[model samples]
Structures are given as structure tokens and as C-alpha cells.
Target: MSERKYQPTWDSIVTHPTPKWFRDAKFGIYTHWGPYSVPAWGENTTWYSYAMYREADENNNPAYHHHLREYGHPSEHGYTEFLPEFTGEKFDADEWAEIFAGSGAKFAGPCAIHHDGYALWDSKVNHRNSMNFGPGRNFVAEQEKAFRAKGLKFATTFHHAFNWFWFPVWNKEMDCGKPENQGPGKFYPKFHEEHAMPDKEYHEWWLGQTKEIIDQYAPDLIWFDFGVFSLMEKYRKEFMSYYYSKEAEWNKEVIVTFKEIAVGQMLGNKSTQFTFAPGTGIMDYEKGKLNNLTDNMWITDTTIDSRSGWGYVRESGYKSPERLIHNLVDRVSKNGSLLLNVGPRPDGSIPEEAQYCLNEMGKWLE
Candidate 1:
């Protein structure tokens, strides 16, 4: 076993190299299945719940009108109401893993938590999780087990770090203001201008939820959404240090990925103060493809939905399998990996269009 010594400082983490497996494993699958998939009407993202709450003209806002016609007003039928309806009755982790494995994906997993603040795992820190509230199933653990059983690297994506600020509209009188409906405050936390930056309590909660996931699933790859740059410096350092240390103890080479904002420079200074230093982990481009090859290893995350959305839509315009396969070839030629996303319906069934794409990719690979 190699000596395990990694301090939390940037100087220490910067010395860590990208895992060899990730560099070689050029294809992976990421799923965006959660409460948002219930609504599933966004353009290319899964922010319909939050976007519907915005006060926009009905003529210009389809999401808002759709919400009103289908589920009533946001005040009467808030996003939380979707929880009870999100009973993943058809969810089969083993089957989903088999599809990913058949797709020639070297790794696969779920977006464990999106900006909606609903955790897919059985989380003790946050009460509003899949295990306790929606599906009554530890989806994260199931995927991890199934993926590993299929000899695929297990990964998990976290977007909850931004939930604190993502749903500011929920704090309004028309949303979670009514006495009977104030309960969502636990999930959609009230945010004011003064509370722009998350306070100590929120930071602690973020750290706790992250630690819980790490402890429970031991995901081989942990991916963070863009808002991680807003996290407090100490909390960020603590997470990286703890994750690196834990991987060292397990005698495994794991990966931690972040968006450009988390690692990019801002206003002439380094973002996160180099907390997520270069060479410490992989850099991910969301729904973006690099134009040219680079010396550094990177990954592109795009959706198979021709509509470009990452969640399930009633009519998800799926891209052709040939296009996706060509993208995989292009990415691999440039020393990059592709993390393709598929959104499942509320009942946990993968769309046939997505299945078709995956099957075509499998044939091409063979």
C-alpha cells in the first residue's frame, strides 16, 4: 500500500494526480431522475419547479402556464407536492445498470441530488430524501450496488449545494408563505439579500450531507455542480481533505470533478482560492464539447435528449444514436471523456428513445 498523506491545503491537493481509470474509461452514463423528472418540462435543464414560480407573462412562460393547468398554482400545488406522487413504482436499479453496462459505459450513476434539495439516498442530515419521502428507496445505494455488480465504476453527482439560493422565489408570499405550506422551508430554505452567502448552519448541513454520501456509498467518482464555487473556503477544503483521506484509507484511486467556475479564475483571482487546484481532480464541461484536444484530461457531460434537457419531458426530442456515438469518438480522440445523461420518468422508466440510443451505441462499440 502506498503511504497515505494528503493535507487539506492547495499545495497538498495540487500534487494529487488524475486517476488512471478515468482517463482510460472514456464513456459513462449519468441519470437525472428525481422529483424534477415529475414535472419534466424544462428546455435543457431541470429547473422547471423553480422557474415556474417566477412571475412571468403567461404568453411568454410555458412552464408557468403548464404548471397552472396541470397542477394548479404554485401556492396551492408547490413543488413539494410532487413528493408523494414521485413513488418510483417502476424503478429498477438493476435494470438501469444493465442498460448502462450494455451501452458500453465504463461507469454509471445518478445525480444523487439536484437543486430541488431532494436526496436520492437515505440521508440522515436532510430529512427530505428519496428513502424517507418520495420513493422510499435508497436509490443511490441501489445504483452503486448494481453498477459495481456489473463491473462498472460507480459515481454520484451532487447539485444540492446550490439549493440554498436556487429557490429564492419559494420564500415569497405566493409560494411557501402560507402557514400550512411553510413546511417546505426545510427543503427550499428561505433566503434574503442579507443571507446571500450561506451561513454557518447551512455550510455545516452541506458538509454533513456530503460526508454522509461518502460514508454510505463510497462512490468511485463524486461530481459537483457549478454552485460549489460559492461554498465557504473552509468547508470546501474540509470536503476535499476528507474525501482524499478516505480514498487513501480505502487503498483506491477515486475522482472528484468540478465545473469551470469552481476552478476558473474570477476578477483576476483564482476561484475558490485554488481549493480545487489543478491536477487535484477532473474538470467537467456541462453540455459543452471542447473544440480542440488539450494536454489536461477533461470530461463533457451532455444529454441524449434531442430537446437538450436533462430531465424527463413528455416529448423529449432525443438526438440520433449516430450523433451521440460520433460525439463519443470525437471526445475520445481529444483525450476527453463523455458523460451522457438520461432522464427517467416519474415512474422510473427510462424513455424508449434513450434506450434506442443506448442500444445503438452498444452495437457501434461492438
Candidate 2:
């Protein structure tokens, strides 16, 4: 309704203020699912694509050797081969929303996109996504409507900022360099190759995908990954400015969560680190906690499978229900919210252990 209230500057943007909903909502849930879930392997299970293509001799790449034995060579069977396994056969969005609501989450949604570069929604900017390749369903859209129907705030997290260096685009021994892989399946940024340092075109596409989600979903929160540094100043400012502006038009109070990074590549000064100017948005901690409570609002996102990966792994060990309930209590005590992550099986079913923990937490909260 009004002209863009936020400008693309730290001073202009920080003044927009954090929304009240976030301060009050002490818990949320978001899922980590993709083609990587198909393998249901690897330590950091979501990193299967990246780790599977590296040399066996490289520092402790079990995925590389496992890939060689299970699927053969990466030259032939790249990540594209795993797409069929992600059928999402049992995926019921309404049920998922119910499960999240049952867990007492105030907000919930999909990770949207990860470092592997697959989009969960029906995306025009990125053709390699679940709607087109794997499940032929808009995962993001489904979660948005279902979660909202259950009276939970909708949110989306994007890790595509790290996608720029996710693949070894210059390596000829793998699919990351092939013409076929360049389209959407595995077309990563050419950062390792030559002079294309910042990769302006790729950066713009990053902005494009964010704009797509903001316009399509109008989420209550946007959680950014640590790769925020790679998006650089201009692109970062542009997207935030647009997101804050669109919030006004939608008449919604929204939140954006970003984390700190001490080092980043492709900088004019390579030593330049990326940290979000405080007061602009929520600061999220990854698998860690603040020593003491402070004035600012924050989020702590940790996996449900405490002894394993972020995405589904065959041998994941989960947290006890009491532990999870205590985790929620602790975060709320310290002026923070807990955003718990769950990795569903390839067939789109949340693991029984995770489901049990969630239900127990729901009962505890009730």
C-alpha cells in the first residue's frame, strides 16, 4: 500500500524492527529433505552429493567409496540417478502439518532449498526441483497451506547461498563439469575454475529464487543459512529490502534469520567476513547455545537425530522425549526459540522415533 518502507542499506533495513510474533513464539519446526534423503546415508546426510564425488583418498569420505560400490562411478551415475528414489509416496502434507502442530511448534515449513541446489517448490527460476524431477509435487506450497490451515505460521529456509561452492564445477572427472549437469541437476557455480569470482549471474539467480518465494508464499519467516556471506552486499540488500517492502503490501509481520560467518571466498578482499548487522533480523544459532540470555531475540536450530545427520540417515539416533522437552524449556528460558529439524525418509514418512518424540513433546506442552 505504501512505497517501500525499507531501503537497501544496513541503517534503513535495521530500523524495520523484529516482529512480535517471533518473540512470543518459542518453538518452530522445519524439515530437511531432498534427493539426498534417497540415499539415506552419509554423516551429514544432506551432503551426500558433494561428498560422493570426491576422491576416495580425500580426508575421510565414506560417501565417495560407498558411492563407488553402490552406484558405480560418479562419471556415469551422478546425483541425477538418485532422483527416482525420492518418490514421496507417503507424503501427506496435511498429516505433516498436523504432526508439526502436535509437536507444539508455533511455526513450521520446508527448508525450501539446500546446498545440493534442488528446490522443494514449483520453481520457474530453478527447473531442477521436486515438482519437476522427483515427486512432481510442490513441497513448499503444500507445507505452506497445510501448516497455515493448522493455525501455525508458515516459514521457509534457504541454503542455496552455499550452493555456489557446493559442487566442483571445474572437475572433469565428475558430472559437475558435464553439459547435462549444467542445467539444473548439478549446475553449480564456477567459483573453483577461474576469474568468475563473485558469479554475478548466479548471485542474481539466488535473488530471483528468493523473490519468487516471497511473492508466491508470503511466509512469516525466512531463515537464511550461514552461506549468507557468499550472497554479498548488493544482492543481500536487494532481497531483504524487497522482502520487507512486500511484507507491508501483504499486511504481515515477517522475520528473517541470518547467522555469522568468519570467512568467505570470492570477496574483493578475501579476508572480508560476513555478519548481519544486528537489529535487522533474528540471529540463529546452529547446534549451539548462548551462554547467557540477552536483550535480542534469537533462534537455535538443531536436529532431532542428535547422534546423526540433518537429513535422513540409516543409523540416526534420536533425542529422548524428555530431552527434547527440556531443550524447548531451556531455549524459552534464555529469550530464544528452538527450531528443531527432522529428516524424513525417502518415502516421505517421518521416522517413528522422531514422531514419538514430537508427540511426547506435544503432550508435555499440553
Candidate 3:
């Protein structure tokens, strides 16, 4: 596919200190905590919602099936059942914040929403939210309060844009070529035709969801996942306006993250394009270190896992603490930040491997 084309018009008008907090902070944690993580079952839970619907062989090595048996099929022991298990009772926000601080993370926040369309905060538009359904707690709100109390800037990452297009990949209801006459559960429906105002509804609903997060939690940063390219120019402007207005009200700067492919358009001749431009980040290259950091500041988000999976699964092995410390130092020396990920279990507890890594990171930072 050809590269996406975007022309942004609002950078100087909506500027923030670029080489400030992000440059000095040096490290931040990207916590992929969600209802899916509750299962703590397989290597594929993070991608489970998408990988499950495809046949066992088709979805690039199906791990969801293994997840199903490990936890039970979604039909019998449905994913929803794990919600009650995510009591988050053992999750001390302050303690986590302290760990982040000790680990030298200048900021920390949870995945406010992922491709499954669930919100971590108290979202009025989406009933399937952490505050109402899963843990029955305002996870984002609580985290923000705790991080702020510890003097760390709060951030929120949203993966919902991918959910719209990505969710359909697994859901039989929306898959193309399915017969309309077929019964509901057997095959997917003609979602575009059946639903009235699908675009308007989803776009509005997504916007409303962001509004609620900004209003309630006041995130210092709002990171968007893939599919932002799909949003129309008008909607993008509207979204930027909303974000810039809110940032001004808070009298603080913010950083928005995007994948490397999407960064150029988002940052078009303007600061509002991204908190830290995409491609500005770095990662370890097998041959050697990634050289020539972008003229603009960037970040490299990596995991300790040597495997492809984001979370802990059987046989998952972590990189040596020495390697991770060196990687962090390499990025920092090149004027970049390392946004590390920690895949927590479903019950809101950090896995032992993750904790050990963070503890080691703390010692290195100290």
C-alpha cells in the first residue's frame, strides 16, 4: 500500500515545549492493563479479540485457540467471566507509582482503551468499561491521581481507532461475503448496511469517549493507535481543536504518540501533530544500535520479552537487565526516551518477571 497523505495546518498555533519533559524524563511506562489481561492465559490475549474469529490456521499462527483451552473457549468460559477476577485489590496505585518513579519513569498511565472498545475510565458512552463492568473501579482516574501525587505527568493511550477496523477482522458479524440470511451467531451481519449512520455514530461515540477522558482524568498526553489515517480531515481538525483547547486550559504541555508510519502527517509543520513525533523514537537493531535519530525528538517503545507476545506466557523469556539498561542508555544518549511496556495479569497484578525487571531498572536508575 502507498503511504498515507496528510496536510496538517495547526502546529505553531498549538505548540508545546518539545525538548522539555519528555527529554528530561528519559523513561515512561506503557501499561497494557485491560480486561483481556485479566485472563493471564496465553501469549495471544493482547491480540485475542482479533485472532480468535479466524480459522485456527489462517490468523498468522493462531495463539487464541491455545488461549481458549488454557482459559476455556470464549463461548463456554467466555472472556467476560474473567472480569470478576480482576479485583485489582492487590493493585496499589501509589506503590506502582513509586515503582515507576524509582524505575526513573517520568510518567505513567494505563491503556485507557484498546482494540476491544473497552474504556478504562468511567465512560458514559461505552457501558463495557473498567469502572462499570470489569474491575468496577475508575482505574484511569485512580492512576492519574496517584501519578500526579507522585509528581509524574499522567498519560492515556487509546487503541480504539484500531478496534473499529481491526475488530471486524475477527467478528463474524462484520466480515464481508457472509450471507445475510444466515442466523446471527453462525455468521457475521452486514454491519455497514444494517447499522444506520455507522460512521457518524462511531466517530461521535469515539469523540465523546475522548471528551469524557479529558474532562474527568485530564491526561497530560493522549496516545492514539492505528486507523487514525481513516478519520476524515474535518474530524481530525475537530479532534485537534478539542485537544489543543483542553491543553491550554490546563496550562501544561502534552505529548501524543503514534506509530512511525503515521507520525509525519500527524506532525505536519505543527507541534500538535504529536507530543513527540513518531520515527523520533528508536529501537535496538540486531546488527547494532539504530543510528541517526530523527532531527525531531522521538521515543522507542520496547518490551523485555524476546518472544513476539507482549504479555507473559509460558516459555516467555526476558532480556537480561544489563541489555535493557544499555538499551535505555543508548536511547537517552541519542536524546530519546524509552517507553517500556509491562504486561500485567488479569487481576491487576504485575507479573513476577515484570516486577523483577522493574526492580532491576530501579537499581540501575538509582
Best by TM-score: 2
Q: Model 1 off-target regions past 4 Å?
A: 1-4, 58-60, 169-172, 179-187, 190-195, 262-275
| Winner on lDDT (1 vs 2) | 2
lDDT per residue for candidate 2 within 1-366, as digits (tens), equals 137898888888888877888888899999999899988887788999989877867358989988888999988888888899999999999999989999889999999999988999989988878877888999899889999999999999999888767777777778777655575444444435633454777888799999999999999999988777755788888888899988768988998997865554544456655556667888888887887887888889999997658999988789999888888888888898999999999899999999999999999999
Best by lDDT: 2
Q: Which regions of candidate 2 are displaced past 4 Å?
A: 56-59, 184-196, 264-273
lDDT per model vs. reference:
0.81, 0.85, 0.63
Query: Between candidates 2 and 3, which one is better according to lDDT?
Result: 2
Off by over 4 Å in 3: 1-8, 11-19, 41-44, 67-78, 168-190, 193-198, 262-289, 312-315
lDDT: the better of candidates 1 and 3: 1
Write model 1 residue lDDT over 153-205, tens digit each, in one string: 99989888877776654355556544444344354554445356777877888
Positional deviation of 116 in candidate 1, in angstroms? 0.8
lDDT accuracy of residue 284 in candidate 2? 86
Per-candidate TM equals: 0.92, 0.94, 0.79
Clashes in predicted model 2: 0
- The lDDT-based order of candidates, best leading, equals 2, 1, 3
Clashes of each: 2, 0, 12
The residue pairs that clash in candidate 1, if any, are 306-317, 306-318
